[model samples]
Target: MRDRIDEEITFRKLEVLLAFMETGNLSKAAEALNVSTVSVHRALHSLEQGVRCALFRHEGRNLKSTEAAQMLADVAQEVLALMSDGIRATRDAAGYSSDRLRIGSLYSLTINTVPGIVVDLKVRRPALQVELALGSNAELLDKLKQGTVDAALMAVPETEPEVDALPLFEDDIFFAAPANSPYAKLEAVDLRDCRDETFVSLGEGFVTYHGFVEAFRVADFTPNVTMKVGDIFSLMNLVSGGVGYTLLPGRVRGVFGDKVQFIPLRPQYLMRQTIGVSFLRARERDPNLLALMAVCRLRTRSVG
Candidate 1:
């Protein structure tokens, strides 16, 4: 076998040689590879010296490839192609699904945020089939930990050692009531004064539920929750039909338009939900998750 230190022909040099062979000119090869002409010339000269052969000869002001160079280029092409296939296979064996990506999200996000991200991701990866699973924050996080989904779009959890989170935006919690309710006319609603009012809330395990409980806790009283629903749409329907008041994130303000009114909460009772995408720290380098993270970063910049 050849000595380790004697191996000088690298993949990068072969790539430059292939570019020069394809373009047939130093400046053109440099333009194709986005490198300077001097860099390309140096790489080709270094490659010729490493192989200890005359791979090119001067023809007027240009360099022409020899028959040996043509044979080496053919072998280089096959070697590079095989290396790429091996890499993809290795990633697949390591649990990186190249053809499909599973994503978890909240029911409330289906209105706008989820769709926007999905569309942008699709644009970036047209051949990728995306599967969306909708549930509460706890449900999605559980699915993420279980590996049932690649990543989750929800309220970022406070303490998850194995999960990596990228916050996209922050939404404030609002006091929701029926459009015709007396509370709708107020500039802001204080939880302390609404202690006697019956309320509907999302069930436990939802981020909104946690926010609701904490806000009331800060106000020094427990809310008179008469009913607990599993999803935000149902809770919105209850509030719209005059069932009872509920708390909601500002993102859902336009969902029920004229049917439900979302009012700002008093300063003391205020809460803000940090919405984001989360995935396993181990899978953070997975190509699909990387693309999702890139899209999330773009969304964060746009939202901000």
Candidate 2:
């Protein structure tokens, strides 16, 4: 029976003995017991056989531990301590976790619009945290659907049924030119105005660039794109340096200051876009998510 019970002894008993040795006695270990010292002794009895060795040599009421017990002392302590730490980590990640609203957006909003909302959100919820992830419009919408992000500020197709859209503000796309350049002199220029002009197109996947390109095709023109770039910053730099002209979001003017001018879009070829807050309605009841939406809705109103 003892040999069979020895097979049942586990790392659990070794951990208990290690704790007992750290206190230098049995009485102190009894205080920390989930069961009883009697149970600990019973477990230890079977444990010694499992290891096929004597952990302690009992002398009257005192038990002096052997070499194997001493060897496992530090390793068992580390393993047990880490177990406690793991439980604490799980508790923290579960409830009363960090109070943060993780907002994602297309590259177009990452700089100006989202920052403005973040400033207002901090004012209303000072202790509330804000995190931003910037990506393509399609990728951002995917993140919103994934529950990884709280909300997305993007110009998505109006018919996306899985998400609820809270319309924020609308801005038209227009032709851009370096400050003091000839294109800036034009008050209202249609896509045809630039049919003979060199166009600098942004890379695929960007909402602004894709929108501008699609709108140009609608107006029956394929731009004589002299240059193509991946990012708005790079495209803007090219435009500023007179590499080529671009049709872009009006908000881009805010980025370059007086470095560029955004002339009015014409032929009423308006790619007037409604930027909005997109989120899953199923999580609408979450308290922190509500606070975040409230701030976004309020900011949109203020802009309107």
lDDT scores for all predictions? Answer: 0.91, 0.76
C-alpha RMSD of each candidate structure in angstroms: 6.4, 11.0
For residues 1-304, what per-residue lDDT tens digits would candidate 1 score against the true structure? 9655335699999999999999999999999999999999999998888888889999999999999899989999999999999988987765586788989999988899899999999999999999999999999999999988889999999889999899988999999999888887889998889889999999898999999999999889988889999999999999999899999999999788889999899998889999999999988888889999999899889877
Give stretches of model 1 more than 4 Å off: 1-95
TM-scores of the candidates are: 0.71, 0.64
Q: How far is candidate 1 from the true structure (C-alpha RMSD, Å)?
A: 6.4
Q: In candidate 2, what are the lDDT values of residues 1-304, reduced to their tens digit? A: 5545445456688677876887767766766766687877776677677777888888999877888878756666787788878866764453223478778887777777888888977888889888888776777888887767878888855677778867888878887888787767777876776778877877776778777777887879788888887777788888888888887787666688878778887766778777888877765655666776788778767766
The count of backbone overlaps in candidate 1 is: 0
Q: Global CA lDDT of candidate 2, please?
A: 0.76
- The lDDT, on a scale of 0 to 1, for candidate 1 is 0.91
Question: Residue 94 in model 1: shift from native, Å?
Answer: 6.2
| Per-candidate clash tally | 0, 0
